[model samples]
Target: MLKKLCLALALLVMPLPFVATAHAQGQSLNDILEPVRKEVGLPALAAAVIKDGRIIASGAVGTRVLGRDIPVTIDDRFHIGSDTKAMTATLAGMLVDEGKLRWDSTIGEVLGADLPGIDPTFAKITLEQLLSHTSGIPTDTKAIYEQYVDGKAYEETLSQSRLRMLRAFGKNPLKVDPNPTFHYANLGYVAAGAMIEKVAGETWEELIRRRLFDPLELKTAGLGPQATRGKFDAPVGHDVDDKGKITPRPWGPGADVPAGLGPAGVAHMSILDFARWAGWNAGEGKRGPALVKPETLKRIHRQHVTMTLENPPPGTPKSGGYGLGWGIAASPWSDNRPVLGHNGSNTMNLATIMVDPQRDIGIVVTTNFPGPKADEALQSLVRTLYQRFAK
Candidate 1:
């Protein structure tokens, strides 16, 4: 395994811009990625760098799963957690653009009788507030399982009850005042999904597929359980032990889907498909129809709410700031350049998406191991890669 990793790293460093047009424009895509492959214990990883509307470099390393010899490919799908939030936010922006919804429109208007005890303050909560994390909704743990726990009859019941519980709790009022301070709330996105359904007359899944994925030609991007069961080069989630042995386990999609929270997380895709998204965000390429006009995309990236340096989740790096659905962090190795993206982790998966618009470069790193060092490794890799390729 070490030998294969080393060889892959060596190839990543070689200068082949002429023959390997993928590495053109002085970009050493792989040279900086070696540490990520070595430190994360990832069985497989793939990344693509886009520059000036073209795929300048793209490659994959390692195996698709531990103990299997299958090589990872750019097309191999992987779970992309909170990165899904940006897509959800984009969908909301599109609706706003269509005059179907307003950024300052109240959630009570969208949810109506479904959310019975909603505080009057919630009536002032806007679609933009939810997208920007200013809605002040509690990040409900039970609500998460209620929406995503997959199964049959009982699962559905639990889901509805959780939604009801959330509504009941809302009568007390938001933990923080609405529409100002930045509070990262997954449930807020769930509410946004519900709003999309109420106004569009379709489920969140259907709206996302029609509005974002289909147009982008992101064939591999979709909801979890269904996509995992389908025939595709999908990477399996794994738990890595202290000694680095990968152990396979079952972590079926949770109940976030039924709770109308699929917007915050639950989307899955391959590096290639995700690269297309990064490309679009970086103004490098076009997908299908513009999901939102370029102006809308700019609005999505703007810092809508301020988060104190002290507010990041307990273990998150001190350098990062909450921005809309994504996190903004200063690139330590690039004279503190700003990098925009999101990092996602659950019990079975770890993922990061780092995009530098100034350089028109993006990197995504994912691992099945939910280990202590996974996030640190990913952050380090992002800085290392930027130093290597960005002038």
Candidate 2:
């Protein structure tokens, strides 16, 4: 179907208008997410809402297999795709707080002369520029981009393995250089992850487990396919064919994204845990174990660059900007200004998390199936949640 067209369909593709301002029916979160799952034909779907650092409402609906009778649970994991960017950026901030790295530290400075074939210009790229996707790194080009989706083992250390992909981009001139407009660059995040590897002197996976996941207690969080290694205990991602018949594909090499691209996305967890992280961010560092200082989290959420969507991608906002890891926009139904949320997918799944920092509330939704239909379903569900719960 539409999912097989390209890796990601960038627009929301509004299927119909939503009753965003409708009063809550005292309906459970399951009541809200289940119908959307059925109507959209997603293999499985999950959602949760967090207020004041706690999950107040959460649920899941549908089956692991699209046409089968296997049921899913609230604990079933779903890949959150690029939504992982925010978490990676946060981990980087922790290192910065410890003075292990600086926001302005250059890749050249971090890797030193040890990395081979890196151009002088690329070496000059900084943490802020890289994280913000304005460091002159091009959005992963098609050939280079596939390197991430395949889950290839990049050889040695995390930084060295990931940096091999950057040699292709090292000397490439930027579309716009020196603090240009926002461009979604997956490679840029990988580059940043490399810097993290050097500073932490550990694999990105180890650092995430020790520094973030362990502290936050994101029990369901992991890298790659949500499906367990040998079984369909979790929902398996599907690949839709030309005639629209979805093939249920279990977790395998093709299902995993390259670890080098982990900083850009490739994270999977239950909807509840995803919302927990969002809620922590919603508190703006005031709650949830104080992962970073309040101002640091605020800086992460602040609008750093604006995006113009005159003739935008399919899923892009009509008019909006981007913060460090979030797309900054306003909601008509909620009093939430700069409604902070992001849509994530790996061409086989779709997920979203919306946080209203003003009310210290966050909402997250996910679908095991991907494409335009998934986007339409998630955008509608998010609208319902914010309209019903936004302060």
Candidate 3:
């Protein structure tokens, strides 16, 4: 387990961007984030709230990278990591609406022709299983390594490698049998993406870009690293060393956890656009971009089963269940109903989204650093936003 250290006092080193909280409240969203960015020692932090398919508040603060003068802006893209999972699941739901796929479609049924040598047991894995993280897929493997570590992406396309990995995975026993127990697995999503390709004849990335990003009009949305190639278009991810030194990383193959793992993560966009996306989810398909029906959204957000963390961190549920792409937990702040949201990280950047459909409020936050510090900071950030905006 990683140790927790509160560095909120690090605000002392940060330049005073505002004279007081009153200024932050009356000023741009960036002003509100300035203090939190400083307190968390973040190179950059961006956040927003959305209600009824519209962004209500959004802000960005700090520099694009450590030791650089390039300031973070609300329009700049920020990596959202595993938060992309919700979008992928939403895509699957759209396909379901089109009669191209079913929630219970089995992995072997969809891709069996492409892989004849796969294990018979894997044939039973269903789309619902994959989306809900109940698939019997192992959480780790060499292919998983390649998906995250650019040096190991190998020579094959992400989908191709994932297919091969699936075959290899089929040969081995499942990590956990499909049922209600939740076991987070990136490969499960990769497999889900492969199934999407088999049915739609397009890569997961291409599908997401066309179906979701295009229609949503998310101007800042893009795949791969948040930063532009060879340029600081936005905040680049940062890696904090054990010595507490923060190093800015450039855009590269290793810039993200795994570009090939697009189905699981690897999406970035502006905080405002992110808020729009979350707000759409909060609408549960009643809003425009009517990509999926309300019922389908219901199925996606419906809790599948409880999940157990071996070493649960403070403030997180020891046994939380997951829906298609979001974590389902009852927070005291929610007035006793479950909230839907997720956290994403590629080991260098972190983003989180928490939404309450009952209250029609959604909150999102991103930081340019990864690890326990970023997680702790963002957790507090989301709670603050939710408490403020959720009525």
Best by lDDT: 3
Question: What order do you get sorting by lDDT, best first?
Answer: 3, 2, 1
Q: Pairing residues by index, what is the TM-score of model 2? A: 0.89
* Model 3 spans > 4 angstroms off: 1-27, 141-143, 146-154, 175-179, 242-245, 313-316
TM values, all candidates: 0.80, 0.89, 0.89
Better of 1 and 3 by lDDT: 3
- Residues 1-391 of candidate 3: C-alpha lDDT, one tens digit per residue: 1111111100011222323223212224676677777877788898887877666677788888888899987788998887888889989999999999999899888999877777777877899989887886755556555434544347777777767767766666554543466667787888898898889988888899999999988889998888878799899988777797766776776577555678888899988888888888888767787888888989899888787777654334666678898888776666667788787877678888888888788888888888776777787777766766676
| C-alpha RMSD of each candidate structure in angstroms | 6.4, 4.5, 4.9
- Deviation in angstroms for 230 in model 2? 1.7
All models: lDDT? Answer: 0.61, 0.74, 0.76
State the lDDT of candidate 1 residue by residue for 1-391, as single tens digits.
1000000000012223322433332233454444467666666565565555456566556665667776766667776667788888888888888988888778778776788767887655778888877787645456444434434435454335435544755566655552477666666776777777777877777888987888888888877532344432566666555596666543343311332346777677876677677767766234436778677777787667655545444235454455567666664464675567787654455567766667777666665545556666655655544555555
Q: Candidate 3 lDDT (Cα, whole model)?
A: 0.76
lDDT of 1: 0.61
